[model samples]
Target: MFTLFKRSIVLILLGLLWENASRFSSINPAFCPPFTEVLQAWWELAVSGDLWVEFSASIRRSLAGFSLALLIGIPLGLLIGWYPLVRDLLNPTFEVFRNTARLALLPVFILFLGIGEISKITIVFYACIIPILLNTIAAVKSVDLLLIKSARSMNVSSFKLFLKVIFPASIPSIFTGIRMAGTGCILVLIAAEMVGAREGLGFLITYSQFNFQIAEMYAGILTISALGLIVNQGLILLEQRFSRWKQLPK
Candidate 1:
């Protein structure tokens, strides 16, 4: 908690500046409201349940896409890293897709899949998979050779070796990938939602902007920022849980 507060001090200072600046600046209040006014707007949305409803929609899409990426990326990456044949066959395809801008393909998805939940979720999944897959592959390949040899000297089965030695050693790197992909999931999801959605935090932002509800738009942006922070922090906690072994005395 102390660390979190320490990290937030600068942000709090900035918020205070923003609140005071709007109060005294010559700029139009409609274009740049006080931070407190934005908070009030956020509170109003929350009380009216609009914020919660949109938050629910956004979270659901993000979770679905991110989960799919995790399930597929980890195993596929493991196979690609451990087996040269799989790597040879899949790396080219992965590179081709990864190099393409996800948003650029959004038009194609919408053309075939339409501007529905499926297209938005698909885009998020596609955007998330690359980082997780690439990171998992690197993690597996980077496992300690000494550890592998030590396990081999014990005559451990391949599966047992992977489970007991390789996987645990790769946990840190895997989580790094997860964090990257997790944050990317939100960015891509917001873009997807903004492009075509009736409801979501992204849609709320767009709608508020179109209606010139500046405070509400700012409120939506803040909500998305908070959501991204929560997702990243949650992943960090999970990573720490899996890495408690690192805390053991040398």
Candidate 2:
């Protein structure tokens, strides 16, 4: 705890120095407000409940999209990784889709899904799928072949082999994929909301920009950074809990 506190203090001091330097420079505050002013705006927004509503909406949309991606990506990846024929058949198409920029599809999504929650969610889902699928495939493929062969030689049931050997081996990789997907979801949701949404942190930032509320915009950006940190830490905690068996000596 003391270490953490010390690190935080160092960061705070660095931020203060940066803010002071920027403020004293010829740079306009509208482009980059002082940290103190931004924090003040953040406090006001938090107390007004506006921040809460936007934060909630953003979280909901990101989670929904991430869930959908996981549901579809994991199973399909497992199948492909387990079967050579399936992998060969799907690899080309999967590679093509993965290489395509998800943001480039925003215009098409807007056309089909419209400028609603559907469009935003679809963007998030699309952005999340590639990482989850690729990670799942890698995880499944990384299971030790000798262990699988031993299980088969012992007449272990296919289902049992997967449960006892494959699943455990793949867990760390799956968690890695989930963390990547979480970050992707947040990034995609921000872009989607900026395009068309009334209530979200993305919307708040864009709106504040248009209204020349530089401090408020900075506050919104800080909120996003905090949210991202919380999400990453939450995933780290979950990974530690579930993959405790994989832990190594420090």
Candidate 3:
């Protein structure tokens, strides 16, 4: 609670500084609109229900992309990490693809998939998959040797050993991947929206800027920041719940 209070104070101070710059300093209001004007613009959008529409649309796309990544990346990563043959065949390709900037493929995806929902969602999926896959592979490969030895000493079957020892140990690293992928989903979704979106916070900001609505543009940006904060907090809570075993003293 005290941490949250300190954060709020910092934000309040920043807001006051921004308001002063826009209203009293030599800064041009055309470029840096007062914070109150941005808030008013946000309120107007909220009252008309436009804000919710864009917010929901972006959230849906982000969640859908992230969900697909998790479903596919985790299993594939497990296979690659578990099997030397699979790793030999796929690791080179994975390294190449993940090293490429996902945004650089945005044009390729748009060219092939067209400027539609499919294109946007596909880009988001592409952005999310690599981190999760890499982290899962690391998690599986880095499992403690002692755990494996103990399980083998008990004459555990291969499948049972994996389920009882490897999977649990790998979970913490897997959650790190999940958190990274979630952030990537939002960022890629926003970028995808900028290219060909009709209904998203990215679209709202672009549209507002095109029409010289500075306040509205700022409101859209603020909304995106707020959404990122909420998503990060949710992921943190999930990590805490699922990775609680890691809290035990080593």
Candidate 4:
């Protein structure tokens, strides 16, 4: 506990500053309520079941989109990275689309998919897939040359070589991409929900703001930040587990 306090002393001081400012400073509490009010709002939302409903809707969409990206990204990335012809052919297309802002395509998605779950999920998928794909490609390409040569010298079959060496070595890098995409997908989903949705954290935030429920708005914002932290931490645990597994003997 002492060590933890030492690590978080700065955050504790900031919280104190925020509370003091809200209580004593000349700033408008309407625009920026005390941190305690935000916490109280979060508790109210949680107890009333509003937080769970909104969080579930947002997380469900985010999970769907992120899952789809992972399903496609890893295999496709490996294919592109491993084959020179495929890489050469698709590199230009990937570069062009990747550089294009995903939010810019929101209207296109809405037009095609409508203001529904599909459009939101597709947007999240679009936002997440690029980083995941690029990272997986790099992971595949970056596999150690020495390992490849050793396997080849032992007359390892091409298929066996990949299963035994390249794929395992690439796992950490792939997880790095997963971690990146995990955090990003949440923010993207929030934006998507804000654009069109009756129930979601994003909706809750916008609704609260429009209605001037400043405390609740802050609560919603804090909830999103908490969600991002949880997702990142969960991904970190998975990464650590996989990295450990990869180190074990086959």
- Report every candidate's CA lDDT: 0.92, 0.90, 0.90, 0.91
Candidate 1 lDDT, 35-140, residue by residue in tens: 9999999999999999999999999989998999999999998889877999999999999998999789989999999998899888989988889988889999
* Model 4 TM-score, 2 decimals: 0.95
**Candidate 2 Cα errors over 4 Å, as ranges:** 248-250
Predicted structure 4: lDDT: 0.91
Positional deviation of residue 36's Cα in model 4 after best superposition, in angstroms? 0.7
lDDT of 3 by residue, 158-213 (tens): 99988888888898899898888888888888888888889998899889999999
Query: Which model scores highest in lDDT?
Result: 1
TM-score of each: 0.96, 0.94, 0.95, 0.95
- lDDT string for model 2 (24-80, tens) is 988777788788889999999999999999999999999989999989998888878
Worst 10 residues of 4 by lDDT: 241-250
Candidate 4, residue 81: lDDT: 83
Global Cα lDDT for candidate 3 = 0.90
lDDT of 4 by residue, 53-163 (tens): 999999999999999999998888988988899999999999998899988888899999998999999999998999899899999999999999999999999999988
Q: How far does residue 51 in candidate 4 sit from its true spot (Å)?
A: 0.9
Candidate 1 vs 3: which has more lDDT: 1
TM-score, ranked from best to worst: 1, 3, 4, 2
Off by over 4 Å in 4: 245-250
Report per-prediction Cα RMSD to one decimal.
1.3, 1.7, 1.6, 2.0
